[model samples]
Target: MAKIRLADALVKILEKEGTKFVFGHPGEQILPFYQALQNSSIKHILTRHEQGAAHAADGYARSSFQPGVCVASAGPGALNLVMGVATAYKDSIPLLVITGDVSSQLKGENVFQDVDINAVFEPITLQSHLVKEPQEGIQLLKMTILTLKTGKTGPIHLNIPRDVLQMEVDQSLLDETVELNLPNDWSNLKPAEKLVENSKKPLILAGAGVLWAHAVDDLHVLAEKHRIPVATTYPARGVLSEDHPLSLGLLGQRGTKAANFAGKNSDLVLAMGCRLSERTLKGLGDVPIIQVNLDEKVLKGSVNIQADVKKFLEKIRKTPPKNTDKWLEQLSKHPKTHKIRTNFKKTPLKPQRAIKEILEGKDDSILVNDAGSHTTWVNLLIKALESPSLIFSGGLGPMGYGVPASVGVSLARPDKKVVVVVGDGGFQMTLQELATITELDLPIVICLINNRSLGIIRQWQELYYGAPFQVELDNPDFVKLANAYHMQAKRVDSPDDILSAVKDALKLNKPVLIEVIVDENEDIPLPE
Candidate 1:
């Protein structure tokens, strides 16, 4: 086997693993890897910031169901990826992070751009490695990939020293194939199946695991065959079409009223692929829960089954469909309804009206939302037609995730329509990615909800603290900002103009931005 630079060998390994895109910025320490990329077929996306690269990788992983790869230099560049990595870790998304470190001989010498990246990422990654020797790099990478594909996927870290990356290594070592052999002990699934079969008024609570396991079709089959209504967590919103008869919508603090009502009254809660977070279990009284997940640590139910979601559902589908007509009809009669003025005449538009207009009849489009009070509105109002149609910062709730995530989504699914909804405060967080969008000529429609404040924090202050502090934001004209990035843009202040503006933006062949001015004081509705 011929010898090649460690960085070149790493690129060959990545190509063998089916990686097409690498997102990150280049620096002096990582120049060897960048030089290796020049002759490679893999496309490297140069993000404006390291955090954007990490979030973009996160979005790509969530939509494509593949491990996303990102790189950064030592010190602050690698540190910037911490928040993005933590966000992915919390959501259980598979990501591979490669960071350059100081040379092996310079350990603890305070060399330029040197920091102990492995120690910093210990808590946030499933595995962290510091590769000082060239021979160990490929084996560590194999281990990282194997761990990512196994149970409960999360981010993995690799910090390679600058000298090690440039050192020569045998090509045969890098070309070795690693196989994953995971034990499948479905012993506990039978109990869960027996419980589901016995319960008359059972409800299925689907979560992000449904997407992770790629079992959306199996979930639909099981739900339909058993005639059990489904209530999803926010991250798992679109596992079943919102309009499906079995759909009870999201159930949580910001969940739909009908979903919360149905969840509270069900005798058996069949939770699949979700952790049953505090937000989802808030007001539901002590109802018996049968939780099925790959990880047992997060299970909080009467019975826990540690197994893959898809396999468990397949086995459970053997039970014949039950007649729960009476229960479904009773629940259907009490659907929680709220009045929303879709056609408001006010100059400063309402948030609900804007969301309603944008989502009107666009059931098939993919929506990515940023964190803030605006997220509550999108989660409560927008309906997704398929699995993974809605992507949001579920556990971390980072403010500037929307724009960069949308850029990654556009690249992953170029044929599908992608839309991003971000508040003024959240929009400014990663707004610099507009250059990336324009440079790539991705046709993503950005809906900027301008409220001139952090609405969620302001709402909390108004409700409990009786005053707003550090909530007000000074923002630029988004229309002008979009123009500066050479993108088509429009400003909509009236509710009547929202639908038409969004339609126009969607029809454009290139990236477009719609700035929607919303009332700062128009509070999001709370569940009764």
Candidate 2:
């Protein structure tokens, strides 16, 4: 049997797992692994910052419904990826995160750039372990993939030492890692099915789990066929097309009034792939809930079923619709929840008007969102179409996610143009990725809502505290910044020009930034 370096063998194993790309920033300790990648077909994306690489990997995972892979060197390199990893974990996005470590002998000693990586990541990841040997790494890789797909999906971390990566492995040992299989799919659905059959005014609360299970179509069919209204969690925005009459839009904190109303009045709630967390269940009183999720620990519904959302929906789809004329009539009274104000004529561009204009004449572009007051507007005003794809940091609200995530989205879904909605505060955080977008020449439209304040913080400060301080921003000329990056840049100071400018930018089909000037008054009206 021929021998191979452990790093080379791991790359081969990643290939077997259908990993096509790995986003990362390399350091000296991981150079051996990087060298081994030279002979493989796996594409490596070099990001300016470790956080960018992690978020890019997250974007790819969220967009593709496949495990996104990212690499970082040990200690500081691994530490920088914490924000992105925690964000993905909060949202339950599947990712395989690799970090290079010091040689095993020096792990506990205060070696340069060395820390307890596994301990640091254990809180954020489903599993965090250091690879002890080449054979152990092969098995760990397989286990990581299986764990990601099987139960509560989230990120996993593997810290490999430099020497361990360079250790020689007997080529025949590779055969031991050849076959992979998931255990018999387990879900207790009989009680769930019975509840579905009996409920008259049932509402389906779809979560990010629906997307992870790749059951968007099945969910749509279940809601439409049964005529049950569908209210998605923030991350599950596009699970059912927002245009559908039965769609209630997002529920909870940043929720639509209609969705919250339905949650309050529904006789029964069918929560699929999403835990009925406090953020999602606000204003929701006691109601019988049938929850289907991959993670058993989070199943707190009245009828908890550990099942794949797609499979569960498939089985429940056969249940016929109940007579719900009264429910529909009551819900119709709250139909004002999802209307995009198409005609806001505010000076200094209302964020709502800006979103409408940016989205005008758009055909299902993948929307990437950054966290801020602008995020509320993007979520509130924009309507997801048939097969809508959206990526945002739901669990952990991170500011710099949009730009780098868009890079990953562009690479993963080359056919669809990317529309990134960001606030000045958030954009400034990961602004360096503009270079990455330009270097790849990705067709991305950056809608930078340049309100010179941390708008959301100001809103809270004024509303609840009767004072606003430290939230205002001192911004740079974003147009000049974009130009400096050798990308097309436009500044829209007038609200009316947003429509035409964004339309033109969308047509360009290349990387461009539209900085729309706005004030704090233009932020989202209090969330319903």
Candidate 3:
């Protein structure tokens, strides 16, 4: 049997599994893998930082609905990926994190660029492995990929020592594949069906699981057939169109007034694929919660169903309970207080007005938002229209996710217009990726909301800590920075000019940055 380097074999396996891109920064420890990548069909995207690579991969996974692959060298390089990994883990985004390790002989001997990468990632990963031999490494890689694709999906880590990657392996030894067996029990769904049937007011709380299961159509069908109003969590925003009469928009903190009102009033809450976080379930007290999820561990409600969300929805769609018209009519009478005042003509434009304008008619465009106070504005105000998905870091809301994730989204869906909404504080974290965007010439529009501070934390300080201290930021001229990267750029300080600026940005064939200046003291309005 012909022998091949383990690194070469690993790339072949990735190709076999339909991996088209690998996002990361290469280093001396991972040079062999980079060399192996040179001859493969897979494209390598070199990010500005290791954190950028991890975030880009995460964004790719979320948009593409595939296991995103990222590689980094040992020590600092691996540590840099921790935040991204944690973000993906919390959100259940599928990722395959590959890190280079010190040679086996030098283990614990303080070799260069060597740290306990597996130990650092063990808590965050679905599974973490250290490759000790070539054959075992290939098998472990195959298993890791399978784990990434199956059951409540999440990231997995594979730490391969430099010498093992360079070792020779028989070609036939790398041909094994791992299969995933997922559960499909419909036994407990009857009680849930009855719960919905008997309740005077029932609501559907959809979460990211609906999107992850590719069950958007089923979800819509189930909601419409039963006339149950749907209130989605942030990650599941676009599962149903916000324009749909049965849609209650986003629910929870920074959620729409109508959605929260409906949730609080509903007698039976059919929480599907949602963890029912405090932010999502706020103001609702002791509602009869029926939770359904693929992972049994996260399911908590009066009745729990552990099954594929799509299959369960399909089953219920076939035999939906009657008498939901009155419920729908009652919800329709609830006033919507989450409206964005687009008519506010003020200098230092309001973030709400800016988000409203950017999302006005771009229903087909994808909105990738970074975590901050600005995110709250976008969540409450931005209406996701036909086929437009909103990507957000729900559980682990990281600051630097917006820009690089937008790059990944653009790469994954080049046909769709990708828009990034990020605050000045978050944007500065990964602003180095502007070069990557220009280099690829991806047509992404970046809506940089410049409030000159860590807006979310500042709000917390003012409300609870008495004063906003240590949250102020010294930001660069974003327009100038965008121009430096050879991209078109503009700054908008007037509310009335926001829509025009966004329209102009959408017209450009390449990436454009629209820096909208807003008051630092402005607070996001809470739902009444």
What does candidate 3's lDDT look like per residue over 1-528, in tens digits? Answer: 999999999999999999999999988778889999999999999998988998999989888888899999988988999999999999888999999888889878887877888999999988889999999889988887876666678898999989999999999987766677776666778888888777878888998888777788999888877788888887888678888888888888777777888888889888888888878878355788888888777878888888888888887776555587887777787754365666667676777777788777345678899988888777777776643378878899999899998878888887888889998989888999998889989989898898899887887888889998889987778888899999899987888777887777787757999888988888876555
For 419-506, candidate 2 gives per-residue lDDT tens digits of: 8999999999999999889988999989899889998988888888998989888999899999999899999877778778777887
Show the colliding residue pairs in model 3.
none
The 10-residue segment with the lowest total lDDT in model 1: 334-343
Please give, for residues 445-520, the per-residue lDDT of candidate 1 as tens digits: 8999999999989998989998999999888888999999999999989888888888777877589999989999
Instruction: Estimate the TM-score of every prediction.
Output: 0.95, 0.95, 0.95
Question: Which of the predicted structures, 1 or 3, would earn the higher lDDT when compared with the native?
Answer: 1
Q: Sort all candidates by lDDT, best to worst.
A: 1, 2, 3
The lDDT per prediction is 0.85, 0.84, 0.84
Least well predicted 10-residue stretch by lDDT in candidate 2: 177-186
